[model samples]
Target: MTHATHTPRPTAETWALIRDDYRSGITAPVLAERYGVPERTLRRRAALEGWRRADAPTPSLATPPAWLRPPVSREEALARDPDLAEVDAAEGGDRIGLLFDPDPRHLRLFAFRQASEAAAMDRPVQAVSWMRLAQIVDRCGDRIEADGRPLREVDHLRAAYLRRLGELLPEDMPADDA
Candidate 1:
């Protein structure tokens, strides 16, 4: 069996009305009455145009949405929850590796540490290090280029990472990697 799809072609005026009255809580029946068109047709056209009722009450800026609200301080949170305080107190033993947070500073630190460890293990850190440092360079590129030239800022960061690489790796590491 072949199924045929019929798409309703709305006129300019109807489109303008659709755009204008979209979130105005005007039902299809009301729109049909006002536009002298069938309620089903208006609904079909609205569906085709991907219009939705914007009836949800917008939260006031004076009182932010819960997620956007500032979180209480770590100490305050811990004070309220004793179990959390216990966890904070017991933060160190076997969970050392578990605490490897991937935040920007930690990410770079991790790369540096990995480079150092890889060199100790007699494995080159080149393949992974370049990609990781490139990500950092790209993320901070906008801020780094404030003094005019872009390549200079990237080169400076590259030089710093390269210096760390030199410090960690054997002196025989290829110079062209710079």
Candidate 2:
């Protein structure tokens, strides 16, 4: 008769080394070499323990930092569930406005109900510091309105376009070019 022997589980010392090194931005390859374990084993253990990749930051807790100072402070976070904090945590920092460039032939005004709506649907977009018609134009190429009107730039964009237009347009206006 033959007896089958079971390999001993990793010691607490091994687990501690894994955690400490992981938080300090050590790579799995390095950890594997130091611990004499396979790289895949280290990664699998990290995954099971909810350790995130080195490049990503840990999600915030149920209650945000007091420093957040939400523009519209409700009693609770918008999601209202601590478990969902992971999702919100990924969206750390302030809100942003995303601009979408529809097909060249399409012409739609800014009619989104909420910023989240645009994010929910993956669209060609750019985040703008301020949500203004002119700001959108500055970020994207010039666009004409559906009514065949050339939408003029506003404020900063106006100056930029005027300079660009000057470079493109001739100084002398032809009699028929009026």
Candidate 3:
């Protein structure tokens, strides 16, 4: 005759502690091991109780930055800026140019913003690609703006890149203000 081992269900206080730890960004597996519960059990209980990680961005915070937001439709863009209607008609009414022109400075700024967003979302590869694009645009812009043409300082871009680098590789890069 073999005796089966039995584990007691977690008490209310124990469950509360588990929930708190989970919400505080502790992984379910780690919490399970620490609290003497099965990983699946902890995850299931947290799901049933609608537990949200504290580090997760809220809905408003998750919204893309204004510069990254594209116009929903050509009609909407035209409606907002009636002046663009002429340009739209000239471009066959299909391509409604919203915001930035074909300027290298604008392109660089756009790329930098995209890189920043990718970094914020923990997408290191994408962030790096955008950063590279930004660098290329900046270099091209420099050549285009040769002969003492006035251009905005790129210190902000450098600062942003450093911040993103820190986000991607915390140990290698120093932290800076966003």
Q: What are the models' TM-scores?
A: 0.25, 0.28, 0.31
Candidate lDDT scores, in order, read 0.63, 0.55, 0.76
Compared with the true structure, the alpha-carbon lDDT of candidate 1 equals: 0.63
Residue-wise C-alpha lDDT for candidate 3, range 1-178, written one tens digit per residue: 9997888999999999999999999988899899999999998887678788898655464676654565357788788899988876755422222131245676687678779967876677889999999999787886765643333448557878989966788575656679
Q: 1 or 3: which has the higher TM-score?
A: 3
Best by TM-score: 3
> Once superposed on the true structure, which residue ranges of model 1 sit more than 4 Å away at CA?
1-10, 56-178
Residue 51, candidate 2: Cα error in Å is 1.8
Residue 18, model 1: lDDT of 63
Residue-level lDDT tens digits of model 2 in 95-145: 222222332222113322223334343321421211233345444534433
Q: Write the per-residue lDDT of candidate 1 for residues 21-123, one digit (tens) a residue.
A: 8557787787777766677877877767766677845545698644445556768878788788666654442245434322344445545655664455445
Q: What is the lDDT of residue 112 in candidate 1?
A: 60
The reply for model 2, stretches above 4 Å from the true place, is 1-9, 53-55, 59-178
Clash list (residue pairs), candidate 1? none
Worst lDDT 10-window in candidate 2: 104-113
Best-to-worst TM-score order: 3, 2, 1
